[model samples]
Target chain A: MLTAIREKVLAGKRISDEDAMYLFASDDIFTLGALASHVAYRKNGRKAFFIRNRHVNPTNICVNRCKFCAFSRSQGQEGAFELTIDDIIGKLGKGQATKAKGMGKSRSPRSVHVSPHGFSEVHIVGGLHPDWPFEHYRNMLSAIRKRFPKLHIKAFTAVEIDYFSRISGRSLEDVLRALKQSGLGSMPGGGAEIFREEIRNRLCPEKIPGERWLEVMETAHRVGIRTNATMLYGHVEDLADRVDHLSRLRRLQDRTKGFQAFIPLAYHPKNTEIEGSYTSGIDDLKTMAVSRIFLDNFDHVKAYWIMLGEKISQLALLFGADDIDGTIIEEKITHSAGGLSGEKLTAGQLVNLIQKAGKVAVERDSFYKTVRVYP
Target chain B: MITQEDNSRISRKEALSLFKNADLLGLGMWADMARKGLHPEEICTFVVDRNINYTNVCINKCTFCAFWRDADDADAYLLDRETIFGKIEEAIAMGGTQILLQGGLHPNLDISFYVDLLRSVKERFDINVHGFSPPEICYIADASDLTIRETLSILKSAGLDSIPGGGAEILSDRVREVLSPKKIKSSRWLEVMEAAHRLGMRTTATMMFGSIETPEDIITHLDAIRQLQDRTGGFTAFIPWTFQPGNTELEETGRVERTKGRTARTSKLRVQSPATAVEYLRVLAISRIYLDNVDNIQASWVTQGLKTAQVALRFGANDFGSTMIEENVVAAAGVSYAVSTNDIIGAIRTAGFVPAQRDTHYNLLRFF
Candidate 1:
């Protein structure tokens, strides 16, 4: 039965929902991987993609607490923290130093793999501060841009964008346009817990609705800001829900062609309202592979190494993942949720991992530009 | 707590359990971790060897074979010493470090013929002579009216440096009976290999999968090799290649030629399609994780082509099998992927690895 579906996929026909369901339920992982890898090889050939960027989560304060979030907190909670503009610039400067140290660590004297202009992008996404006005968000981007104009600013998830629209009394388009004008280069894929309304209502009812999040992303794309998409899986969702979530992203990609990558974020149930163990490596690989198979129009599929540790991320290359987010200097969102994988990987480590996976390690900038190809 | 540390020990049960239940990606993770632990540096190894099949005449007409010819067939001509010596000379000039000499189990060939051939090759060229799989060794023993140990002793004294692990289609006798009943039984193949190992001769092990075998049968095969390696530690590497039923009797039948189901309990082995690249990598990765005592796992590029073989290096294979200047067995089986030395190095470099040349004993000879 899987052979039949695999033949269809080889023929370039889209697999049906039933085929996906069967694949999810079947124990024949290699067959599904074969199909997914077939699609991936056709799409990208042997090149595996990654980005060289830094992650800056500005604040942890939020108005609404999503059940699966381990990073959010009330304004005065015990562990809540926020950064001022100067503090962020300081960290970005420090991050530059750290990345420099990464490239200069006791290592092979091969050509340096970092971009000529170091730190290609600054990835900024964080909670919605109840008291912070719209200008705080706009000023944050302006300050970062003012300090480092060359760094592409990928900030503000759709949830944050929707929240900004609500608090600032602006249309979604107006909010996106304002941020873009303030040096918001693109959007990050987060806060998209699950697309199904049932799951959304139970877990993150106070957050933007699924339709609203999609609307915000579509508005951002309309304003000429490309973005990435993500799905938080391995929680209260079925196989049909996963397929449905991906299908929604696929439909949007077909319309706007704005999504540069699809990242399947594995749900880490540490210190969250929804209590559970971490998803197994098998589940993580399957989710990544299935997303790659479903989102044919999306150009890249990323295995965010922050959540799925280093080894599994390396293995993910053969299982339909073409991107391992980046050499994230520091990560707090997943860390707060009991994520134990280190906060950062050195530039040399990233190149060695990709190369050892028998893939050409291509260092990419924010818009998926080839920064360096570590062949 | 299997951290990415070197020499982290895992029990056979744990390894087999992973092979049975772990997802393909999970298995790859374990294998890659192991690979990293074993080879912390950025080196992948290959050898430059010419596969010199001395003759094509055979008595064991295995069902999956496409290379054997009848004794009276017009093409069934054995190479004399001069032709063989000229081939070796050409190989030496082309930078070949060894020669992989294998052939069908010819019925009329006596033990003296093999001894003379080995002596002639050694007398001519200063190259490693890795020849004679276990089945071929067993055939020579029976024809010479000697024990397997005696046969290996004679061949070793006559300049056979090591043995290549061929003719190990599937170690499970149940599957072996249906695939190649005329070949040496599973135990005899192992016994020949073990005798060679006891003689302090290193030999590689191989598994020809994707035929009439279940996952359990694969485990069985791996378990056999693992146990033997544990005892002697003489096995240098393990190579797993998919059964290419292209021009063979298996392809002609369109089904397994014997029983539909080998056992009443087991489901019929499907000959509908060959194992895909995914299956090949799965087996390769699992073998690396399982056979901890074995140091190297080679990629069978002749059957899988360059792309999959390149990918296999990441999965588990630390060594590329050979640069077959002339290979007839798999080529006759109709799935040949010819690659030159430059092509191999380019593929390895493009795949982000440094390609080094190794000899039969896996000693690094040069790095390109």
Candidate 2:
């Protein structure tokens, strides 16, 4: 049965939900590996990839107390932080330069003031705060882009957008339009749990509904801003639910064609509303390979270093995944949730991870432009 | 395969048969080399490193892990600075070399916190700073409002040796979306690691599989790793393990509900036992054989433990991974396995190979 599924996958046939179950239960590990290999070969070649960018987490104070959260605060938390526009830029330059130092001690002293190539993008995302109006977002984004026009600004996840729209008394369309006009270049696909309401209901009760989040992404895509999609796993969600999540994303991508990458998030389960969950390293690898097989529309499968730690991310390269998202200057959402993914990694370190995996490391822009080849 | 009795291991004919199906053959003369080495290398190994999760009270709480808690949790804590130093000291005194230093995605711990921690360790003893897994880096970035590179730079500058190759579970958005939905997905992980590699930090790689995927999925994981390895020659090794599902909500009552809590954790260790671990060993060997580019094939005594780990040597593993001073993640999964340098050397000697201490790049530091 597993071989049949493998055959189907190798033949480029879309694997149905039923086929996944049979493959899961069967004992044909090699055949399944072969099919996955076939898929990888047919699509993404062996390329260790990273994005040269930074995450600009605008605020940590949020209204939605989702089950899986270690970063969100109710505004009264002792250590809650919200990066002002200046603070965000400050973080970016410092973050990138810091990463560059890892590339070499000499790399820094020469270009500390100007920052040669450390920080990547100003990844602007934050908690879904009702208090912060659209103007706040506009100001933050406009300031960052205006200051660092060369830097790609990937701002706001679909869930945050939904939150902002409802609070701003604006439609999702209006919200996106305003943000786009305010220089929101792209969307970061966060707050997307399983598309199935069953899983989302139990795991994240207060966040946007499954369909609404997709609708927001669709709108962003329609508005000409490319975004990435992500799935939070290792929680209450099931295999079928995971499959449905990917299938749904695939369905949407078949229409909008907006998603630049598909990132499978490894649950941290550290300090969140939901309790008791963890994903094994093996599970992390398998999920990535499955995402490559399942999400046919996505061009890149990112092994974000922040969540899945470098070791698993390095191993992730072999599982049909291609892209690793850019360096994050200051990522708050996950960190606040009790994850120890990493303090941060430099481009040099990323190249090292890929080299250890025996793949070529390529730096890409937010728009998926290949920037530089490390080796 | 070098042994005559191992003729039953794999045939060149079988390897040739696999070449067309396996993607490794398409690159360079890997097929020819693999043909000589019996395709798939058929041997893989892992290293045993202590997880020493110093503290569970983290500020960065992305939604995919269950190993941490608030500082107030009954089990939450911050290992006394002395205690952390003492653990490494003890490991070093006992012949440990590598220390996987990681903590909760703590947000309040600023640049000075790590600088102080790293300086303390560097001053205390000579140990490889296999610390600051990427998530920790991202958390530090967020806490300090620095980019990953900036965080890495500060850490590296402060006697921070190398980054631990932890946290990278998968490199696909679909899987990350459902699993960690909020945590930086696959790409961010890759981005940071690449940045570090460019910075000259020799890191390692790893993968956790079997939770929510098909076999084809595993290949995708391999593809992602392979691609990165082709770029910067910074990563030193790759380790893969199964998720420990004890306190985890899904495994507790899911389809495998029959699995008892604590007891099942032990069984899960065996899930990657000598047999499975050896299969992975073969895979590791195959990785080396395939990635002629990569040099070391490590034995994972950490996840598989000492006994089975020793057996990995004959299966094609070369390096006896790290002499971890403390390990916590696997312990969280409930595996009680820790070994000092003496233990590693003893294991290697028993396995008929000489033991050698090595740095992040696998360059032999000294063989006692």
Best by TM-score: 2
Model 1 deviation from native, Cα RMSD in Å = 21.3
Cα deviation at B140, candidate 1, in Å, is 44
CAPRI-wise, candidate 2 is: incorrect
How large is the C-alpha RMSD of every model relative to the true structure? 21.3, 20.6
TM-score of chain B of 2: 0.75
lDDT of 2 by residue, A183-233 (tens): 877888888977788887787788888899899999999989899999998
Poorest 10 consecutive residues by lDDT, candidate 1 chain B:
B258-267
* Per-prediction TM-score to the true structure, in the order listed: 0.54, 0.56
For residue A329, give model 1's deviation from the true position in Å. 0.9
Error of 1 at B323 (Å): 44
lDDT of 1 by residue, A144-202 (tens): 88888787899989999988988999998988888899999989988787989999988
The pairs that clash in candidate 1 are: none
Report model 2's TM-score to 2 decimal places. 0.56
For B231-254, candidate 1 gives per-residue lDDT tens digits of 999899999999987756666343
